[model samples]
Every structure is written in C-alpha cells, then in structure tokens.
Target: MTACIDTLDTPAAVVDVTRMQRNIQRMQAQADRLGVRLRPHVKTSKCAAVVEAQIAAGAQGITVSTLKEAQAFFQQGITDILYAVAMAPGKLTQALALRRAGCGLAIITDSVAGAKAITEFGRAQSESFEVFIEIDSDHHRSGVRSDDPVLVEIARILHTGGAVLKGVMTHAGESYSLNTLEALQAIAELERSECVKAAEAIRAAGLPCPEVSVGSTPTALSAVRLEGVTELRAGVYVFFDLVMHNVGVCRLDELALSVLTTVIGHQAEKGWIITDSGWMAMSRDRGTQSQASDYGYGLVCNSAGELIEGLQLRSANQEHGVASFEKGQNVDIEQRFPIGTRLRVLPNHACATGAQYSAYEALDERGEARQWPRHNGW
Candidate 1:
C-alpha cells in the first residue's frame, strides 16, 4: 500500500507536494518578472524530484554547494551545473571528470591561489574549465570585493591560464538577518550592484565576463530591480523554513518541508511533550534565535501541518525532543498531546533538516505519500 505521512515512521522528512509546487512556481515567476534566468541552488533539497520540479518551472541551470551535488545531479542528466563554492585544489580531478563526461560544470574561486590552482590544473589536463569569480557583495561570506583589484587579477588568471572566465557571482547571505522589506531591498540592491560591478570590472580589464549572478532568498524576493544581473540563485526558498519566514521572504504557510514525529512521552508536571525527533532529525539550526521571534529548535504543528501557536520544541537530546508551551499556558498537557500522538514540526533551516534524511515522504494533497530519494555527504 502507498504510505501517507500518518502511516510513515516517526522522524521522517515530509514535503507537502502542493506547498512545494507553489514555492517552485513563485520563485520561477519572480525570476521571470525580473527578466533573469533562475539558477536554483539545489543544495536546499538535494533531491532529484525537487530539482526536476524547479527545472520544469523554467529554471535555467542549478547552483550547488558541493561537488558531490554536481556529480549526483549530473548523473541524473543535469549538465548545466555550477559549483558555487570555492574550488578546492584536491577536488579538481573529480570536477574534471564531470566536465569530460559532458557535464557543463562550472566552478568558482575567490582567491589568487585558488584561481591559479584551477588554472594550472585545467591547463595540465587541457580542459578550459568554466569559472566564475566570487564577489563579496555583502562581506558576509566568500568572494572578492567588486572594487578590489584582485577581482580583475582573478579574471586575468583564469583567462590567461586557459580557463573559461564565465563571469562573476555573489551571495548576499547576510540578507537572512533582515526582516524588514526596506532592509531586504537595500541589501538586494547592494548584492546586485556589487556583483555587477565585479562583472563590469572584469570586462573593463579586457576580459569576457558574460554572466553576473547574485541572490539569497530574502534578497531575491526583495529586490525591486536587477538591472545588470544575468541570473539569480537561491536555495532555501525551495522549502522555506522558519528562518526565511522571519526574514520576511516567505509566509509560514509557504514552508513546504517539515519533520513528522510522534509524541512518544510527556512531562505533564512541566507541560512538556516528548517527541522522537531531536537534533538528529531537526538539525542543530536555531536560526530564528536572534530574529524577532525565537522558535527554539522549531515551531510545533499538528499532524495536519497547522501551526500550534505558543508552542515550540524548547529543547532536545540525541533521541528526544522536549516540546513545551511557551510559558503561562496552564493546560492539561497529558490530555492534550498523549503518547503516540502524531505531529509535524517545522524546521528553522530546511537545508539542514533535509540533510538528516536520505529520502522525503512526499505527501500529496490527497494525503498519499511516496519516497523521493536525496543525496548527502561532502
């Protein structure tokens, strides 16, 4: 018999098919409205089914955080893959293998050393590896500053050393910390301008910089215009978690992913409901901690995925989740959430939570579910 969330084992990763499709369409529409290609970051779901849905919605290519994702997706017939992280010298062979195998796999780097390493390896193997210079648009993570001369130098290294200098890319990851629309727009613009500036700088230096990419979920959704950007890349937006909601990029109802668990026990005197899902399942992401509202590990929800206001997974152990009513709710907890009571918990970081599972129990609107496998490691 086909399984549903209710019939699945506890601590399973569940994706609401309806909500997920909505999210996919929303992001694709946003990209269309902005007149840019959407290269979705597959690192969020790391599942073939999820990535296929994104491509079906008009996404051009995919951005990946690890070469493992590149390899996995490539095996699935996805050729246009961008390895968004800085290229590690040791992984050049693996990257080369993908390219030689007909994968249009692009790699990125931010430092002179990384650039030289990629160029040297490409030259040695007679492979003009496609490369993008990482731009530090928000000073949030990896990338060279748009104004920094190193930007031009890195481009030169790739071009002169027989590598394809594809363009420049930046991720305004810090946008996650902002909740206001104004702040989000400002950072989005900053992300756009800086990344464009980098691309322009490389072109000005007589380099063929064709693509300019920038985004983060909040920034992508907030940006009013992307005048010079060629493409936008975002990950967590696929299955937004509490963090994206707190960032004002998505509504709580838009979160397509959740961890399905069961009330295994209870601490009636303390008003705590013990569950089978712990840090292992939900991940250690307390992403909403510094936001306006802290959602301990995650917010509590009924089995149907409806939010249970004022309740959160307050604490967790290796195998147990301690859920409690946010102070002063003097209700009979034992009678409310007795043993064997099934529940779903929304995650703070969808990517992290999804990593804890190898496959998702894709729950459809009709309540039927099927397994969609996802890859992990490195």
Candidate 2:
C-alpha cells in the first residue's frame, strides 16, 4: 500500500529520510577526506533529531546562528557548539548564561570593539570566554580582512583582556553565486588561505591560535584540499534545495526538503493550480531568482517527488500559491491536478522554508511518516 503521508494536512514540511541520511553521510565523508572535522550549522534544521543524526555520522560538533539554538541543542546534551555569527555586546548576557550553564559554546568577533566587549564581559563574570576572529575570505560578509593590521590588534585585545583566542573562521558565502566548479574551488582555496594567514599572524604575534575554520555548502564540497583548516561548517547541505542545485553542488534527486501541499483548486482558463501553500508555508525567500536557474517560488513535483516539467510556483498569496506551466498553459489543468491531489514543492532555501513549519513529517523507506519537532524564532 502507498504511504499515508499524502493524507497529512496541506502545506506541511516533509523530509525524505533516505535522502536526508544520504546527504548527511556525503558531507561527513567529504569532511573526512579533507582532514577537517565537520561542524554542521544547526540553523539549517534547528531540530535536535537532525543534529543527532549528523553527530552519529561522525560530526564533531554543531554550529548555530543564534543563541537560542545553542541553548536548545545544549539542553539536548550537545556540549560542543560554535555560535558562528559575530557576537553582539547586548547578547553577551545570553552567551554568558549558556556558558555558565556548561554549554561549551564558542563566540566570534571581527572588530576591536567586539573583542573589547567580550573581554569586559568575561572579566566582569570572572571567566575567559573562548572566541574566534572572523576573517573575510571572499569579501562576502562581516569579517576582518586576512592581512588587515587590525586582525592582530583584535587578537591582542581579546588576549590582553583575558579571553581565550580560539583562532579564525571565514565562510565563502559568495560561493553560492557561482555555478562552475572552477569558481567554487577558487573561492574555497581563497577561504582556506585567508583564514590560515590570519591564524598564522596571530600565532606569530605570540598568541594561541589552535583552530582555522572555513566553509559554506558549495566550498565545502568543492574544496580540493583543507591543508590548514582544523574544522568546517556548512548548513543547508543537509537538506539540498533549488538554490544549491542551481549552484551545481546537489542534484534534483538530492533535494530532500519540500513542502507537502495539496492541490485545492485551479483556474482552468489560466492553467494554474491553486495550492494551500503560500508565502506563509514556503517562506518568501526567492533565493533562486538570482541563481543560474530561477525556480520562482519553487519547483513543483508529484506526490512521489518526481519533477513535473514546466510546473512552477509562479505567484503566491499569504495562504495560497498559483502553480502553472512555465512556458505554456495546460489545457486541462483541473483534470491534471484535480482537487485534493497531493504534490510537493522543492523550496528555494531550505533554511527559510523549514522555518515556516514547526515540525517536519519525515517519510522513511517503508512509506511511513513521523514528526520531528524543531525550534524557531530568536
């Protein structure tokens, strides 16, 4: 008998268990081959069950974008954690609380002011916080430059103020814009060299620089080597999406995360199928628009997860999505996707789409489904 997953409520987030596990193992193997420990970013799933599977597959620790993730995962008994975002002074209390509760959380800083904040807070609390210097490898986002004179200055500030210098980290966030292996590999190499250079400079300044970390799903998979990096972090690879597919890292068959939406109605004249999933269900992130291939809201597929050629979520409302053929109108749209027909839409950004739902319906090889709870918000 076919699985009852199709009977679930419309607009639910679904995970193909086999594909999810395969994705996890593929990343673990790549990290092993590169000689760097895999510290997957939990912001992708924010579910303890998912992180547990990553750990079982040989992930050394988990990375987070917010303190809430650090706390939630810590409560589930995950001790090793790296808060990848640059630390904000106002949140030091929250970080301190997690640390005092024995979370083993490491924070990051990219400026002298940020370093001073950490030092002052640690001093007031009479504890030396473990911290990493954010290095900008591709000039993508927040981070001090690899060769900037301020790199050593920030390190000296953290060291002089009683914070343990944990080394450097850089993410080739710009790699997401590249589609060629050569471009991806070049950014990966730049990510490695820049971070290593920062760590070496800090160490040459008579400081303790033990870890050199860098990653992004594209770079992590594209890197031909990881000679000086000690650890790696990549999220979204756990649940490949349209954006990653367009970036040439994963294939359509590997997109494990999708929205299980039911065909509610159709506009026959316009050849559009109205689904219950809207921006509220799939998120408003159009990350694929700027990619090599724009998937509109998402790529539509049958209930069995097979792609439906030309089907695209062309438009959406708060609680509705208009799916239509990209190139031509379906003459019998209603008959093709009759009312209550089940379908799935591969999301543009797995992280954004996953946040729209509180729990995921995980479908296993037996065609059975179960719920996996996830934490959200700040």
Candidate 3:
C-alpha cells in the first residue's frame, strides 16, 4: 500500500482498493445473511482484478449484460456466467461456442419468439441449452410478466424443445428511481415474490424450474428477506455511483471509483476551472438527471478525493470540463485550483466512467497506484 496519486497519469480511472474490497465484503455478507448466492454483475468495473476480488469474497457466479463480458470473464477462468439480457438469435452461435468450450454459460429470454429461436437452434445443434426466462417484476424493462399467460407458453416452448428451463430472473431497475428505504424494500420484496411466483407457475405446469433469481443493488441491499430466491445479481454496487447515492444505498465516502484529472487552465471571469478530462472521459451519461439533485456532469473533488464545497462539474466538452461554484455560492475558483494542480472527479456513473479507460490505477491502502487491466466495447 503506497500513498500518492501524482505518480499516475491524469484523467485515469482509479480504484480505491480498500473501499472496493469493503464493498465486496458488505454485499457478500448481505447475500449470505439473506441465504442467496450473490452473482455480481461485472459490467460495473469490467476489470478482471475487480471481479476476482468479488469471487474471492464469496460471489458464486457472475451476471453479464453482453456476451463480450461472458467471453472475457470465461477467459479469466470463470465459467459460470449468466448472460442476463434477452439473447438475440444472432448470438446463439456465440453462446453455443462458449457452452461447447466448457463454459457453464446460461442465456435469458422474455419473448416466445426468442424462446422458439433458441429451441430451434438447440434442436438443430443437438444441444439442450440452459435458459432462464426474464420476469418483469416492476415493468421497468424486458421480461415476461409474473402472471402473464405467455409465461407458461414460453416455458413449454423451451422445455418441449429439449432446452433446459433453468428458471426465472428479474431485476428491479425501478428501485433505482426510489430514495426511501420503505419504497426500496417494497420493490425488493415485490421482485422476490413475483419471481418466485413465476417459477412456481412454471413448475406447476410440469416444467423443471430450479433457479429463481432477483436483483438490482438497491433491491438486493434493501430486501427484507429472500424467501425463494436462489441467487441475487447487482452491478453498480461495486463502485456505488451518484445514481446509487441518490437511491440512498451508499455514502459519498464509500465510492470506490474516481477519475484522476488535472487542472490545465481556468476561465477566470466565469469562475470555471478547465479540466483535461471531459465528456469523453466521463461518457456523456447524465444518469443523475431527474434525481432529487442534478449533478450537472459530476461532483468535483480535490486531489485527495474529498468534495470541493459548492463546486460541481457544470459542463464538459470533448476534451475539456468546466467546474464552478454552485449558484449563489462563493469561491475563488482560480485561486483555489490553479493551473497544473491535479484532482479527482467523482463521476455520476461509475460504469460509464470506468468504460472510458483501458486500465485502472488501483490505489492501495497507502494510496499508491497500481496498474490493473480492464476490457471494454460491445
């Protein structure tokens, strides 16, 4: 553990190792207490080292948004992967390749059309592909409704076609829109119960349904209990971005990821400090929008990662970011952060910010930077 950020280049993605491990342990403990396996989503960091830390901390398997993630982690010796998104027909060949290569990869589907496609492809390949049906607990995104008649239809299509119906999975993404614990817990329970009900429905029809999965970091952490959930999945909880902060899951100090930037210049009269890090580094993701507080681009912090009072990253261009004191707030921007001064900006979205970089300068307990590789694209 070393103690210095100046040794690393500016505008680099940095991880606080201590905080990240703490976060992993916390989530693992919650999953243990709830009696469910924690399949952490690797989409948040997209870094092998970070995912290994999670696995070492008791994450059973991993939930991935794309096949690229599935492939990347599989190469890292992690075979048990769940491609959580509805599998596109075009990707069946890729999934088959992984399954053939000894990767215990599972795919998900929500529509009968998708299920039929998987069924036909599996039959042609003589493969009993493992599949999980997506459940729409909060109706936020794609999934079959818990009580939808089509739920049984899709189950039959897969089971009859020699595909193994692994069970149902749901993500309470709407839980992110909530700030209070009461609402979050309600959504968590709703997510759990609805998914279990869907699985029960499938089993009652004589189809084999073994796993019932549910998640979303807020829901996973806020859940009062996990009655029938076989596993839980969440991504951003590893880094805990501004969106999660607004959702009341983590505190500012607990955030483990940040962008190390430098002050190259300043717009004096406008009270703006021009940063070398801009939209490119921050990924043009305004996730904090519509929340109780709108952090224009991101929250500004000093060289030590502490919040700069009344200061925020108000605007950003391709290669430049403008930081200023909030309206009616007074601060000498030029004098406070002059040219050549380095600082770290806490991003509004960790997943997006982390994606902007090819590698991370993971900070040790003493604040020293260590290079850790990461994968991106698709």
Candidate 4:
C-alpha cells in the first residue's frame, strides 16, 4: 500500500523502499562481480531498518563513523562492524563493550598514540579488537601515508599488542572535488594503488594483512579494478542524493531518499515558493560546491516527481525553503502546486541530511509510507 500523501507530516524524511532495496542489490551485485565483500557503510542510513535491508542484500559486515553508531547498531544485533573513523582514547570503553557483546569490532587508526591506546584498552579489558591501518590516498583526510614507515610500525604494534591487525583501509574523499570523470578515475586509481601498497607493505613486514578496505562511492562504483581491495565500504549508494549525482556517482533518477515537504506559501510576482522544509529538514550539506551547476540545496520537484524547471531552492532558513524560478521560465510549477501541495526534495548529502531525522518514512514504488526508527548522536 502507498502512503497517503494527505496523512504524512510535513518536513519528513522519506525513503523509497523499493528503490532503496534495488540500490542495495545493485551495489552487492557490483561487489560480487569485483569479487570483494560489500561492507556497506551504515553511517549514511543510521536506521536499523535500512541496515537490515542491506544485510538482507548480502552485506557481510557494516561500516560506521562513530562509537554511538556502533553501540546503537550493536544493540540491534549487528555483530560485525568497522568503525571507519580513527580510534581515539575516549572511544575505547564503548569499543570494548561492543567487543564484549560478541561483536567483531574493527577500528581504523593511523597514529602511534591512537594505536597504543587501543591496544592497551583491549589488553586491560581482556578483549581483542581488530585494527585497520588507515592509509591516506589523497591526503584529504586522516590516514597514514601508504609508503610511510609508520604504517608498518602501527601494524607491528597492533599485531604484537593483543589486537589483530586486520589490514589497511583508505577513502578517496578528494574525489568529491573532481570536475571530470578522468579526474575521478585518476583519484580512484590512487585509492586502489595506495590501499594495495599499504597491504603489501604490511605483508612484507611479515604481518597478516587480510583485508584491504577501500571506500568512497564514486571510486567504488567507477573503479574498473580493485586489485588488492578485499572489501568495499561505500555508504551513500543506498539512498543517493544530489551530491552523488553531481559527483557522477549516480543520476537523479537513482536517488532513493528525499524530504517530503509541503508548499506553504507563494510569491507570484517574484516567482518564489516557500516550503515547510529548510536547513533543519534538509541538512546544510552543500555537496554541490564542486559541481558545474550549483543547486542551492536540491532540485525542486512537482507532486508527480518531475523536476520543476528553473525552480530551485535558492535560500533556506531553519524551517523554511525559498525556491525561485527565472522570470518567464516555461515551467508550470504554480499550476500544479499551490498552497498545501506536497512534494519531495532530494537531499544534497544523504548522510548528513538523513541523520537529522528520527525515523525514515519508508515508501513503496507507488509512494506508500511506513515508519522505521533510526539511531543518532556521537
């Protein structure tokens, strides 16, 4: 059954469940063809229901960004989790608890201090946590350089210090800044090369480097060969947003989640329409900063899900969004959408925007809505 449009609350995050499931299947299929494990990063969808859907689609393990997310998902019975962020001293207790609960907890760290703390915590607690040496592929974020001596040193500490040295992992965060496919492919190759190099380095040091994890939806989906990548850790593909589209990762039609909002006001002369959704409803994530065409927040769509030509969210306040169309633009947005009309707004960043909501209003192909709770904080 489809969700009755008249019954949904304004400024709610909705997921097209059918499309979401298909996205999961498509990603898994791609991973299968590449002969790698699909450890979908669950940070994009903190909703357990969404994770369950991913697990049903053959996700062997899940990736998360924070300890709170790890704890929340652990309580939901998800056993294998990779906290993709660097392991800090503060997160040791939580990671320990997750390990105690039968979770095969793995964390990424690049610094010696971080590694030592993690090793000490595991030892003191009598728990063995797995570790991934985070490799810096593009130098856009935290990670050890693939060729750095520190990579082998950290792996040695983890291997000898009661923690299992799982392997290496890296993210091509810089790929988001690429303006062309060639640039993205170049970044993808670097991602693969750096990760594989780190793995080979660890193995050369006589350490067991079993999993070479790599992520970034753009690189994961486009890279023709992930030669040494044992696992892929993409998160945003489940509910693609405008940023994914702008980055050449997915098309607008492939987006599976959007903000369901209601038109509340109109300024006929100015060609502006206001909706109940704003920065709070949609997030402040302007993932289009590198796009050729900067869509302020997202492309405004009509009730039937067609893009409203020339009408884009020009500005947003906490609870309101203003859409403006160029003067004399040949779009019939007003004729179909008046006050109280409901429509969906695709998000700029699925991870940030999706995190603002308490639950996902799952929708069917026919736009039927069902409720699914989500996790938040930390």
For model 3, residues 1-378, the per-residue Cα lDDT tens digits are 453698677888889899899999999999999999999999998889999999999999899988888899999999989999899999999999999999999999999999999999999999889999999999899999989999999999999989999999999999989999999999999999999999999999999899999999999999989998999999998989888899999999989988888899987888889998899888798888989988888888887888887788889998899888877776777887889888888888898988888988899887778888887877
lDDT of 1 by residue, 1-378 (tens): 989877899899999999999999998999999999999999999999999999999999999988889999999999999999999999999999999999999999999999999999988999999999999998897899999998898899999999999999999989988989999999999999999988889889899999999988889899899999999999998899999998888899999999999999987888889999999989998999899988999988999999998889999898899999978988788898889999899999999999999999999999999999988997
After superposition, candidate 2 runs with Cα above 4 Å error: 1-3, 329-331
TM-score of 4: 0.95
Q: What TM-scores do the predictions have? A: 0.99, 0.98, 0.98, 0.95
The residue-by-residue lDDT of candidate 4 on 1-378, one tens digit each, is 445546788888888787789889989988888889999999899889999989988998899988888888888888889999898888788788778778888888999988899888888888778989899999998999988999899999999999988889999998877756788778888999999998999899899999999978888787777787899989999998888887887878788888888999887667778899899998988878667778887887765566766768878899999887866785555775689988788888989888889898887766577888777888
In terms of TM-score, which candidate is stronger, 1 or 4?
Answer: 1
Judged by lDDT against the true structure, how good is candidate 4? 0.85
Give lDDT per model, in order. Answer: 0.93, 0.92, 0.91, 0.85
Off by over 4 Å in 3: 1-4
Q: Which portions of model 4 show Cα errors greater than 4 Å? A: 1-3, 330-336
**lDDT (0-100) at residue 250 of candidate 3?**
98
**Candidate 1: C-alpha lDDT:** 0.93
By summed lDDT, which 10 consecutive residues of candidate 1 come out lowest? 325-334
